[model samples]
Target: MSDLPPLDPPEGDGPDEAPDMAAAELALGLLDGDERAVAIRRVLAEPGFARSVDRWRTHLAQLFDLWPAVEAPDLFARIERSLDRPVEAPVATLALAPPTKSRLWPALAGLSSIAAAGLLVVLVARPVPVPPAPSARPTAPVVATRAPTLVAAIDPETAGVATVTAVYDAQAGAIRLTEAKLVGDDHSAELWVIPADGTPHSLGLLRARGGTALTLSRDNRARIAAGAVLAVTVEPIKGSPTGLPTGPVVAKGTLSPV
Candidate 1:
């Protein structure tokens, strides 16, 4: 925490009190660069600040959702108007004359209406993407994070010479399956998710060799809460026909907290 960048100074007159205006400005994209970075940090770290930001976002979204659709002014026409201004031209050459002014962006400053038009287009049905959301950022590899995850070992001795491993990613709601010992191609390795109630649920099948990722449904994810068991069984191609296990359990282990 000490190594992280210092947060931007709060905007209120008092040191402890930050005005809701700060959150509104952040949500409205009034802050740029380091100020925006500080706001993003607050959104993730402080629940109160996050709620303020969400409230401002919802308020603004509702206000604009009912706003009348406005057509965009012709951009090319505005550019033409900007170019139509009288200016001295080089008469020495028969070739095309170069532009007299260097500040073209400043000249087209009137295009704010065009920006509003783009907003209208987005408001019709689609959304204009907002940045700095959690999903908008690149994810760090699971191995690189400091947070503990869950890993369970599949039954190693029963199936083959190779050992099998299962690592669960709670954020992604998926389990990664790694097989060090390859099973024969003729059979299938089906994964069973054993809940605390001693009931077994099928999580799907695994590959005969290498690694595979198995995703769990919302209800199934609840069953995987700590103290659950994960195991692999040798079954017929595709998986078990009956809901219950038909083949012998090859590998089984209780889920462990990292």
Candidate 2:
């Protein structure tokens, strides 16, 4: 609900400055609340921020499991109060002498040597484990691979009617549907996956011409696997019959697992 603009580079800033700005924005998003914090963590995990992103990761991880139980408004007020408190300044120390031009080469050489030593230490401390070749690994048994089932479908016209199509993707454990057209100017369409043998289950309503992809519950997946007759019926803007399909059938299809 917060009207935060999408993160983008500010015009005219130097290349190096952009990354720092982005990091600061990410930190601000984390302070927004739980949802924004989770989003920040996900975005920071991408390839661009992989190396130096650990600081924010560690900071956010500390609060990962603490957000949900606390009420947001109260927590926000507490954080705001904490930020308003003053902090004591640390005493300054004498500045170190700047390195001379003649010392630059030696400094660079020393840094290279340290880097090489660090790499060697890492290699010696933890050698990479070799994975077995694909041929060397044992193969598992094959379960029956069924093709995706067409659970429902809709066509624009049939006796002045519209059609709806629904399919079951066993692997994804979801029900997908495609709507062809609108049947009635006022009535919306609702899709139902009726088990051939048992009770009918509502797969939720569909927009007259809008298609949707939805996941089914474990129990519904099992029912669909057992062979369900997918059906579509006309309904009010809200939905269909309180407990049954009271409207005329728009389209219906029998599903067979492939």
Q: What are the root-mean-square deviations of the candidates from the true structure over C-alphas?
A: 21.9, 27.4
Residues 8-40 of candidate 1 have per-residue lDDT tens digits of: 766674745754577898989999999899999
Find the 10 residues in a row with the least total lDDT in model 2.
88-97
Q: Which ten-residue region of model 1 has the weakest summed lDDT? A: 125-134
Global lDDT scores for all candidate models: 0.63, 0.53
- Candidate 2 Cα deviation (angstroms), residue 138: 33
Q: Identify the candidate with maximal lDDT.
A: 1
RMSD of 1: 21.9
Residue by residue across 89-166, what tens digits does model 2's lDDT show? Answer: 121113233334223322322222122322232233232222112243434433434455443333333544333345
